[model samples]
Target: MKDRFDYGQNPEKTKGGELIAAYLCDPETADAEFLLSKAKYKAITGREQKKNADILCYQIRQSFLPGEITPEDANRIGYEMGMRWTKGKYAFFVATHIDRHHIHNHIYYNSTALDCTRKFRDFIGSARAVRHLSDRICLENGLSYIAHPKLHSKGKFKHYGEWQDDNRPPTFQERLKAQIDSCLAEKPQSMAAFLQAMVSAGYEVKHGRGGVISFRAEGQKRFTRLRSSTLGKGYGQEDIQAVVEGRAASSEGRGAPPRKVNLIIDIQSRMKAGKGPAYERWAKIFNLKQMAATLQYLQESGLLEYEQLEKRATGAADRFHVLSGQIKSIEGAMSVNAELKAAIMDYAKTRPAFKGYEAAKYSKKYLAEHEAEIALYRAAQATFRHVLSGAKLPKMDALKAEYQKLAAEKRAAYRDYRAVRKDMQEVVTAKANIDHLFGLTDTQKNKEQER
Candidate 1:
């Protein structure tokens, strides 16, 4: 049975309450607010308590396989997952809707904690945590779980959302890549010939210092670099030359499948199926090495046990949020400083016109001739009236210095933010890897339970 889970924050508390009320009104569902206490009033309380919290509520959807789960069972699973994940910190409401062929649960939880001390942080991999918990719950209840093979693959790959939508027109790079591939397929005699063919295809090519080639497709915003890294290695200069001179075949059809991260090797299961004694020995050694590596990682992180690892992970997540808040505060200050500096400079620059108009008032002919100047001066005065509020505009130099100070502060904050963010990612990744290993072990245990 395949299950899908996705969540998004609700910025408006009233709107979130309305959404929950609407879901509860669904005809197929009864006892909509299952396992919830004062669900209707929590949204109001959440808004009253946390005035600055943008994410007042989080809307979560848990969809189950069609006909696999009844509405009652789905509601139970949803409530269990919600309570388990929230840890009684946040108030939540769950509604089961069988409006479609499949049974799905709509859950809305308050962002603020019950004690009004902490807020629910939707940190990195938090969604995956929900999914993992949900899957485990499904396995416990004798229901099948969908395995996401793509997620298990190695490297930073494009997710389902990141993939190019077929409904939209081809991307600039895609079109250019296709054109380049087409040119290469014809087998040009030289690199120049390939360039000529690209030009004939209505592409504007510019060759720069150090063999840097850039192409500007028609109606494209900016020129795209034709470097080996930008395009695939097969479209590089050497590859192009090889194709042109008929020395080498095109590697387009020969691209290898993406390598997977097989850190959690199920060698024992493979050996148990029909492997030899040598394979068993190797598997034993591999498992021992992995266990040692895990222990070393925990030791370095000062986390001796699983509970300590969990606490450390939470601290890392909190640190990331703190760093993010600092960066945002710095950026906001910098923007305000920049805007103030620009306004001050503009007022100062218009002062000369105001002085010129005042001096020219003695000459009636000059006043009539330079009416535009007087109008500009009046406009500047009006702007300064609104901006400075009866006070004189500050000197441009002082405003500039303030802006520079803010800019420097922002830069320093950003540098620190980057370092903290990197550390947070490392901690989060280590936690995720450990969780994945534990998940694999849980799957094995589940299989044993099934047998």
Candidate 2:
């Protein structure tokens, strides 16, 4: 809680916390006050407060497009959103941070009620409700909200950076469709001629059993069936045959955009896979073209020397591992924190039932009455005993703080993770291409000797 509030209240980010506005709590003392409410709840109910009992507070981040709203206005809007959402039943503070190009608010509200008797229960569709509220508040303050939100099929929302990467390299199926379209454009007179055109364009065509046609692109392990089921409508084998026989118009203007660089082919590996002289020739030419592209990529990246390229590839790979390790470590801590929190909450909720059963002198009737609760209580106790192992159970505030800190670190690391992963892929691909071009592998060297 302190970490979150402090980050937002960074002197550099929020102009020494001047942009902070609080209701029913001081910004500096909010964390303490929030913790006190939890304490009060425990005292009032005689139920132990567990690290994972109910949420101590909820945070909502409201961000404005660069230069869209002033820091003060952003804070006010955030404050309004919190007040309206909680209906002033909970205490909250809004801290507007202007550290990035976007001005965003960190609104933290205590989950425990002002009276400390009940917690603000999060309901289904709370996210949507808050979004709607935020949008309404934004409009009332003369700010814009997302008028049309795009839905992801997987139910995971994409961040701006992820959306920016949508224009990536086409998939294998898309490339094949494009290739088939290119073959059709040649106006082949027969299916045989169309297959020949595909071969000329570096595809290996196979006439399978039952007249099934398939094509394998360079570096592809499996042949893709030329069927409507696989390639979608209008690009099937029958569709191509129809176009070839002039029975139907060709599917026009479909192909992958030219790629900036292509990976080098493993010619020796292809030959060992029973490729003929024709395939060997095509493979050599493909390798040469791709090697040139790789060289250009290296030159542009300032890795002209083979040693420099190797060093870069190794460094990129190492850096990727380090970032991955950091993320994994953070995730591991988070998992433990979450598990402990849930266990604590379970223990606290079932403690009363277990106590009542004990008071009944271990009677089977009482046990039968509260079997589920008593069992859950025992399980939680066992978990604490196993995990803590005589160590003191950390305070709920400390655990929350640790989890928040870890979460922040994870987010920061993930941003670097994406960039480092991209760098590693490019540098590693460049190195592999260089190795293939020079026939650095033993198999390639043997092929060279045989020739």
Candidate 3:
């Protein structure tokens, strides 16, 4: 079992509703968002009517041993755990999500108490307390709990889905680590040789006053100390020195042995077109290797039949289309919001100038001097007034703040959109490659038609 907390809500952020939607998305599950409300305002609308936006909600998650508990049981356990932990002080909602590899619980609680007077005390070490409370709950429910000693200190905290879907570029350190491992595999004769090899690999090497070496990988802004703890023990100065002296061979002792990947390319078969006798033999070998790789991929994925491959590929494509549509929708909304905010700001800024222009009775000299400003004011005034539509316009600062909030939401939405986009691209690429291997591409169809 594991627990994580998203502590202390930011005033600008509005993730409460999104969190609710995410955890309650599984249609098959009952009692999703099982609210344990203590406040007089039970419904979300009533809760929002309080008008206290700061610290809208507190979100936390508890993940269980996969395949151990059913969704129904998990929901009950999560509800019980949430209520007990909150001590009936804060109104909370428990949502058990069974859509991924792990059955997890998402708990969101109103920061304000039932009386709507006092707020939840979010002090230092509150996260640990929540985990401890969860462990007790798990143990009481006959579920295994992760003990303190078994927990990892420095580790990824993302849920399985989030981690699998993350598609950000590799960090500089990751690239550098791969380079170092590859260089070490070649068995460099000395530290100097290693440094030279690093430079050749497109990294800038700098020696400090105390014999410490730092490396700056290509496109990296800062030099990283080669002895930093983030690189682990074996990649440090002492470890490299040991390797240079032939005391250590590779990074294998520091971690698991590297797994080799076999490539799939059929160069030898192509060479067998009889262009040249000697080259044909080599080409045959290359073609055999490529076919071997493709076959291996199919075997691993259990894609034994053409129909299976086709279905998988088309499914991936369909998902890509859906995700593309979602991205476009979000982008469109963001653009409209931005344009509206800009128009409002422009109208407000040019109000005084417009008044002066009106008082001057649309003088040609004044119009020429501030044509753009006057036109913007005239164009936006009606739109802005129409937006207000019989209601008094809010303060300029308030409008700007609302725009900022919308902008933040758009940014968060884009982050998710980008992750989905990356996933779509990967699946689409895999599908195309599979189709090509099977001679199912449009080009192949054209060739068959020609034949």
TM-scores, all candidates, are 0.32, 0.44, 0.34
> How much lDDT does each candidate structure score?
0.62, 0.80, 0.62
Best by TM-score: 2
Tell me the spans in candidate 2 whose CA falls farther than 4 Å from its real position.
153-155, 159-172, 178-189, 195-451
Score residue 288 of candidate 2 by CA lDDT: 58
Task: Identify the runs in model 3 with alpha carbons over 4 angstroms from their true place.
Answer: 1-290, 365-372, 379-451
Best by lDDT: 2
**lDDT tens digits, residue span 319-404, model 2:** 99999999989988997887789789878898999999989999999988777678778878898898889899987788899999
Per-residue lDDT tens digits of candidate 3, residues 35-139?
A: 223232343214342444345457778889988887677767777776877788666666566667887777776665653434575874577778888889888
Those runs of model 1 whose alpha carbons end farther than 4 Å from true positions after fitting are 1-52, 149-451
Once model 3 is optimally superposed onto the true structure by TM-score, how far is the C-alpha of residue 384 displaced, in angstroms? 5.3
RMSD of each: 22.3, 24.4, 27.8
Candidate 2 — which pairs collide? 52-341, 178-255
